[model samples]
Target: MAEPLEIGSLQIRNVSKIFGTFKAVSDVSLNVQKGEFLTLLGPSGSGKTTLLMMLAGFLDVSEGDIALDGASIAGVPAEKRNFGMVFQGYALFPHMNVRDNIGYALSVRNRAVAEIEACVDEMLDLVQLQQFADRKPGQLSGGQQQRVALARALCFAPPVLLLDEPLGALDKKLRVEVQEQLKVIHRRIGTTFIYVTHDQEEALSMSDRIVIMRDGAIEQVGTPKELYERPKNKFTASFLGKSNFIHHNDKVYALRPEKIDLIVGVDHQDARMNGTVSSITYFGSMQRVIVDTKEGQKIEIDIDVWRNANEVKLGDAVDLLWADEAAVELQMG
Candidate 1:
């Protein structure tokens, strides 16, 4: 078993990547602990990929330096950086067998044949693809090919692993399966994983910490629960998860649909927003009720079937109230 990481530090200072006139990444600085699973999450054109590329030494910083374990690696080349990369597509050679593909890096470095064989087998075992050692990329399933790509990346035992939406091409069910596999591999190997993805659910499920970016800047960085329970702003709240933005005076409160529980309360004790249930949508395990309140506020509430069966009806007058603590504080920009 791998020992707990004595996590070296990663620091970036004033890193900017400007493409022509537009700023792809602008003066971004961030620190990540070694062996920490940190994900750079954002929508397209949010500079998350540019930041990852810079970290991998693929693109020039265009401004600042990046340090690993107190040493600057700014002048490093992509090959010399020793960072394993799993790109959006599984870039495996169609003609190469699984073992050969896994051992390709070791072979390029002129490692001994026996050593290369051992490393390849170990990586194959690591990804649970030992049985298909002789299979080529085309002969393997999509998930299998993905595992082979992961094994190839991990075979070299690099200090850092960079994933660029590695599972984006797979179907939803396969994506979930791969997510579990990747998390387990990270735990087993104890390597630093810097995952980049636009999928909020993916980031929330797999990462220890998520950096939410927008327009080439860091919007917020926190744990999944932190971002979900107490977001820093309206954008962070809305981006991280589902939010019901309630405009209250100068500040807007973000009340999560799951958090608005149904309850009976007196006029003074209960804060009620009188509304008519305009429509309802059946969403398998739960139901979504659209309620239009007196103050022209449309509140969308989700309730589990077992809990709120026939409790509220369409065009029926209902009182909607959320706990004061349940409404998280956020600023709407």
Candidate 2:
């Protein structure tokens, strides 16, 4: 068995990246704990990729500092950082088989032949690719190719792994399967993983903490549950999940679809609103009902299909009820 890596914590102190006059990343400060799965999540042009590249030493920081385990690595080159990297393209050698590709890093370092072989074998088992050791890149599926790429990056037991949308090329079902596998690999290796992606579901499902970026700055950084349940601003709330924005008495609040209950032909006094069902969308597991209120606001409620005892249709009058605590107030950002 391969020994556990001495996982290092990372600290980004007011980091910024600028291209001439354009600020790609601006004054972003974040602290990542040892062995934590931290994901940088945002849409395109949100500076997530730029920040990741800076962390990987591919881009120079225009301002601020980056440190590993309390030591400044701002001057370190990408090759000297000893951080593993996995990209979306799965940059595997087309001519080499899985074993050779995974063992390339060790071979280049002039390690012993037996040591390289053992490390490659261990990586193959880590990624569950032991049976396809001799398969070329062309012979493997996209998911398998990605696994090989992961194994290659991790074979040398780097203290940190930087992944830039590594599973973006796979199909939806395959992507989900790989996410679970990646989580398992992280747990077993106990190495710090810094991931970047624009997929909300991927960040919510896999990350120990998510850093939501917007317009080249940090919007919010918190655990998935904390960000989902109590967002600090409108951008964080709407970006992380589906939310119904409610304006009441000069205050703005966000309520999740699942938190609202839909009732027909009955009215209650506690945080209730009456509306007509505008549309009903059937997703396999749940039904999304959009209600247009008399106050000219559209609210959405999610009802589990299996637990829905009452059948709701479009144009039906419905009442929406939710607890006061379920409505999270938003601040202007």
lDDT of each: 0.86, 0.92
TM-score of 1: 0.95
Instruction: Give the Cα error of residue 166 in candidate 2, in Å.
Output: 0.8
Find the candidate with the highest TM-score and give its number. 2
In candidate 2, which residue ranges exceed 4 Å CA deviation? Answer: none
TM-score of 2: 0.97
Lowest lDDT sum, 10 consecutive residues, model 1, at 262-271
Error of 1 at 239 (Å): 1.4
Which candidate number has the best lDDT?
Answer: 2
Question: Which lDDT tens digits does candidate 2 get at residues 1-333?
Answer: 367766579999999999999999999999999999999999999999999898889999999999999898999999889889998798899999999999998898899999999999899888989999999999999999999999999988888899999999999999999999999999998999999999999999999999999999999999999999999888999999999988888888999999998887546565379989999998989989999998998998999989885588889888889988999999965
Model 1 C-alpha lDDT per residue in residues 281-314, reported as the tens digit of each score:
8888998888787889888888898866766767
Candidate 2 clashes between residue pairs 3 or more apart in a chain or in different chains: none
Error of 1 at 71 (Å): 1.2
The residue ranges of model 1 lying beyond 4 angstroms of the native Cα positions read 1-8, 263-269
Residue 202 lDDT, candidate 2, scale 0-100? 99
